[model samples]
Structures are given as C-alpha cells and as structure tokens.
Target: MISFEAVAISMQGRTLVRDISLSVMAGEKVVLRGRSGSGKSTLLKAVVGGTPITAGAIRVGSLAVVPENIQRIRQEIAYISQEPGMSRETAAEDLLLPFTFKAHSGKEPTAAQIEAVLDRLLLDPAILRQKSATLSGGEKQRLVIARAILLDKRIFLADEITSALDAESKDAVFSFLLESDHTVLSISHDPEWIGRCSRVFTIENGILREEK
Candidate 1:
C-alpha cells in the first residue's frame, strides 16, 4: 500500500538516497539491508514524511505524501525507529497516552489486549507498572511494539527494532509481526528477520536493488 517513485533524498546539500523506486503491497513484509550509511533508514523516514524527498514522489494507500496530507498519512503508518522515544511515565501510562489523542479517542486498548500483546512479546504484564526509564533496552523495544499493536496501524516502518533483544525475545517479536497482516517495510540486519520477509532489497551507494 506504499509506493515510491524515482525518490531521491538530500539534506544539507548531501544526497543520501538517489532514484530509488519500490512498492510495498498490503499484508506484505519487505526488508531493506545495507551497511550503516546506505540510506535504508532514510528511505523509511521519507515514507512517513519525517524526511522529505528532494525528488519524485511517495504515496501511502491512495494519498500522496505531501505537506497537507502528511499528518493524516502518519496516522495510518507506525514508524518505529532504532531507539523509540518514551516519556518518564510508567509503561502503562506511556502505552495509554496515544488513545488520549483526539485522533484515537475511545480506541484505548483493553487490559486483556494489552496483557496479551505483552505475553506474545515475552514481556511480563507487570511491566506496565514499572517506570519507562527503568526498563532495559529490549524491554523498551518490545513495549514500543506493543504500543504500535494497540494503535492497530496497518503499515509499519521498523528500523532495527530487534537489535537489542535476545534470541527468544527476537523470535517472539518477529513471529508476532510475521503473523500479523500488517504491511511492513523494515530496515534490519537480522538474518531471521530477512529470511521471513517476502522480499528483500539492499541499498548500495544510495540506490535500491532488489535481491533475488
């Protein structure tokens, strides 16, 4: 449900991505793999309008990723970065914060739903009571995923979200996402994550090349 056409991104006069074009269909999972500076993350950010494309176009569903529609477009997409930002509140409060927004009012996840997501991610339900600052890196990552799940956004832009987890936790996170019907475009170096995806693309010198 996402398409990029002849997309190029530059910042501060430095070109980060060039002439990249691709489409991610609904319910399909795609992975982007590359070295540190290869622009995979930048491409993901561009899809969410976090980084503006200097050339060409991007569209989510039927809406173009332009200034006017960006805010609405973002509501349909969950862009999870390598380090998810969290407030100093308890985990439960952080998770519930989104529902307080007018956009998601009355859509708060029930306690059972929250517990179920935590269980699937191998997290303890009690974690909801702990302060976000006290959670470990992996805990924070899983919690971020849980929040996204609660939002029920169908499009996911995940950037190295599994980097901090151990094997079991990593598998748990991967399995949950894989089993879901979300349209995922992710940046990851994890072999298992890449292997489970339906398509893989690698970025080289700012160009996107689909890997066979």
Candidate 2:
C-alpha cells in the first residue's frame, strides 16, 4: 500500500538516498538493513514525511505524500523511531494523551484494553504508574508501541524498535506485530526480525537493492 517512485533524499546538500524505488503491498512486512549511515532510516523517514525527498514521489495508499495530505497520511500510519520520545508524565497518562486530542476523541481504550495490550507486550500493568522519564529505553520503546496499538493504525514504520529489549520482551513485541494485520516497513539489524519479513532490502552507497 506504500510506494516510493525513484525517490532521492538529501540533507545538508548531500544526498543520503538516491534513485530508490519500491512498493510494499497491503499486509506485507518489509525490512531494510544496512550499516550505519546507509540511509535505511532516512528512507523510512521519507515515507512518513519526517524527511523530505529531493526527487520522485511517495504514496501511501492512493494519497501522495505532499504538504496538503500529510496530516491525513499521518493518520493512517504509525512511525516509531529508534528512541521514542515520551513526556515527563506517568506512563499511563502519556499512553492516554493521544486520546485527549480531537483527532482521537471518545476512542480512549478502556482500562482492560490497556492492561491487555501491556500484557501482550510483556510489560507489567504497574508500569502505568511509573514516571515516563524514569523508564528504561526498552520500556520507552514498548510504551511507544503500546500507544501505536491503541491508535490502531494499519500501517507501521518501525525503526530499531526492539534494539533495547531482552530476548523475551523482544519476542513479545515480535509476536504482537507478526499476528497483527498491519503493513510494516521497518529498519532492523535484528536477525529474527529480518527473518520474519516477507521481503528484505539493503541500502548500499545511497541506493536500495532487494536481497533474497
């Protein structure tokens, strides 16, 4: 449901991704792998308009990633970065913050729903009471994932989301994503994560190439 047509991304006058084109079908899981600075993350960011592309076009579903439709595009996708940002409020409060917005009004997940999501991610419900600023990196990542789950977006852009998790927690995160119907385009160095994807691509010298 996402397509990048001959896209090029540049920052500070230097091109990070050049002439990259690919398509991800609905319910498909794709992984991008490369060494640091290979533009894997930049390509993911481009899809969500986190980074601007200097050339070509990006489309999510039937909508183009342009200034006018960005907000609408964002509504349909969840972009999770490597270091998910969290507020200083309690974890539960932060998790519920999105519901406070008019875009998500009246869709607040019930307490049981919240608890079930936390349980599915192998996170304790007690974590809800903890200060977000004090949580570890892995906890913060999972919390971000929980927020996305609550948002219930069907497309996910995940960047190294499981890098900080323990094996059990990583598996928990993986299982949840694997079982979901979401279309995922992720950047991961984790072998297990890459292995589960139906398609894999590697960024090399600013170009994207599919790997079997």
Itemize residue pairs with steric clashes in candidate 2.
none
Name the best candidate (by lDDT): 2
Candidate 1 per-residue C-alpha lDDT over 17-107 given as tens digits, one digit per residue, 9 for 90 to 100: 8998899999999999999988888889888888888999999999999999999898888877777788858988887888888988987
TM-score of each: 0.94, 0.94
Q: Report the alpha-carbon TM-score of model 2 versus the true structure.
A: 0.94
TM-score of 1: 0.94
Q: What local distance difference test score does each model get? A: 0.87, 0.88
lDDT of 2: 0.88
Per-residue CA lDDT of candidate 2, range 170-211, in tens?
777788776678899999988889999999999999989999
Give per-residue lDDT, candidate 2, residue 88: 55
Task: Give the residue spans of candidate 1 off by over 4 A.
Answer: none
